[model samples]
Target: MSVSTDLTPPAVILDKPQMAENIGAVARVMANFGLTDLRLVSPRDGWPQERAWATASGADWVLEGVRVFDSVGEAIADLKTVFATTARPRETRQPVRTPRESSRILYDDTASGLKTGLLFGGERAGLETTDIALCAGIVTIPIDPKHHSLNLAQAVAINAYEWRTLILDAPPPRFRDSDPPASNDLLIGMYEHLEEELENGGFFYPPEKKRSMSQNLRVMLGRAAFSEQEVATMRGAIHALARGRGRVLAKLAAERAKASSSSEPPRGE
Candidate 1:
């Protein structure tokens, strides 16, 4: 589905977080994944804690605009759909999904003009049954059953990363930006120049192998997909080598003539 320009991702609700450090960590994680809205419900240490900013690293904006609430109901009052993040829910029959699946549903819901949110319990007691009942669904992380519990910040990070992947439209890796590939005419001209020099240098040894060798050379060079500038660069190198060969031949001719004159010496004698 296409992302809408006005789409706002699900807000994150932290219920009764025990540590100021965890709050800062959550803020940092939220910034990493582009989640702008953060709500704190019944934070144990209270709001406006200076220690949080130390742990938030450089994510000051999230902390600067954080919303505080006295209860879970108030925290998500404006949200249309909410998902509770829990390992397991007791007596709750709501639909449950993994992090990735939950992200997809949230993305679609937000695009359709619905306000959404993800509810996370505190570090100590976790979400109460009443709070979970308010959410439409449950998001359970697929961790090893032996250790299903997650750190408060770790849980937020996992969900945030999954959601970010849906919204980010990243391009494939490249070494450097380059112009379009050279035209067929430019390619052919480069090939002919290189082949002419090779032919003069007796590169296509066996007379019968010339055709097959030329075809192989063309195939190999074509695989580079050279840009116009690259083709020009290759042609310049070929021209320089050809001129050097001409100079070498001239030097050899002069040496031969001097030797011949010496052998015909004693003309005066």
Candidate 2:
């Protein structure tokens, strides 16, 4: 087993795709899961499609090197093994395998330096019985019984993600790009500052339930696992809110004093 993320990706063949947009979407998803090889068999809209490139967004490389073929058999001639994607079972006898199972076999083949391919049918109609004949096995994705058909891109994504997971090792994920998680002490300090302002503002008005309210607040904040920067930002926002409220209180007090003085002025007159 290699610790490297890089591995050989299997060839993805789109058979008689009806729409150029769907082909572009398929390319996008394939790029997302690190699969590169893309083959098109008799696209109805023809090749070098402007819509495909536009829909691909920034995945121009996938479309740039795409191989167009006249038929499915011609495309898989170089591949040692080919798996056809199909939703419905045909009357003819062909071994059907799940996405994971098919991907496992693909991984094994690539490990031993064998080229493999995944065949996907058009958007309107899935892989035909005639097309499945060229494949070593059928890959069926288990979906809702009532509506089993999947989008062309979604089918590619499911299989590509599986194949990559089995063949490549992802580095243990971490928030390396952002600040580390805030310590318990820092989070507690933020909570205390916020609660103090809330109390001063009479947010915890019910004296009997103040303890329960604080407990709930603490529980909610504790589960957030805040980052260092996040805690500081929360504290800053609390301070600003308290300052604004203080200004309001001062304004009200001044208004009340002026009103009282005006009322008493009649005695001096």
Candidate 3:
């Protein structure tokens, strides 16, 4: 059986969203969490923003399928269940639940063959009281009390991450690592070669900090966890720099010897 048959993502509704960039970011976060549906109600700058498409990066698919509405009522008109996301307490007596709880409810509703939607408010102002009343419940994220403000796209990302992780079983992140990390011996050789060049260039000034600087350099390189190919590249770069420095130093020594010979008086007479 196909996984799509068993799972249905909730409709993500943005009500009176102000900025086109924020809308684009919401689309990006939605794609990150395997969400696709995007609904807009009365955007300030109008629909089909060139800015939004540019900011979406490669998530043009979400923006392409966007459904525009005149109001929240019209946005989720056909949906039987909906949740409004807000930061503060609403005047309406709607049940307020955490993102996880709201996502769980949505999962249950969608699993049982019911249409569902998630409501988001404008960037400056959250969901209006009337909008909250339309939703069956409110999803509130518990953030630090000192600084509770969350940007429009950030709010979408948080709620979307919760729903995707708790309900949809999001997949692992993709990565590529063909070769193992470089050996310690290779790292030390690279460090020594680079440090010697840096010493010639007087990078470690004041003399007292050279030891600590060396240790810090090693620490920094150690954290890179460089692959064999990356290490090889770095080593090659360092060798080129060192070779250039050697040539310069040799030229300077030759010039100094010529000056000394010219200044010395003839002594064989």
Clashing pairs in 2: none
User: What does candidate 2's lDDT look like per residue over 182-260, in tens digits?
Assistant: 5444655676788899899898978887765775676456445466788898899999999999999999999999998
- Model 1: residues >4 Å from true position, as ranges? 1-5, 169-269
Worst 10 residues of 2 by lDDT: 170-179
lDDT tens digits, residue span 1-92, model 3:
11343567888999998989899999999988878999999999899898888777789999999999998777886675678899865455
lDDT of 2: 0.78
Error of 2 at 240 (Å): 94
- What's the lDDT of the predicted structure labeled candidate 1? 0.81
Measured on C-alpha atoms, candidate 3 has an lDDT of: 0.78
**Total clashing pairs for each candidate:** 0, 0, 0
**Model 3 lDDT, residue 250, Cα:** 98
* Best prediction by lDDT: 1
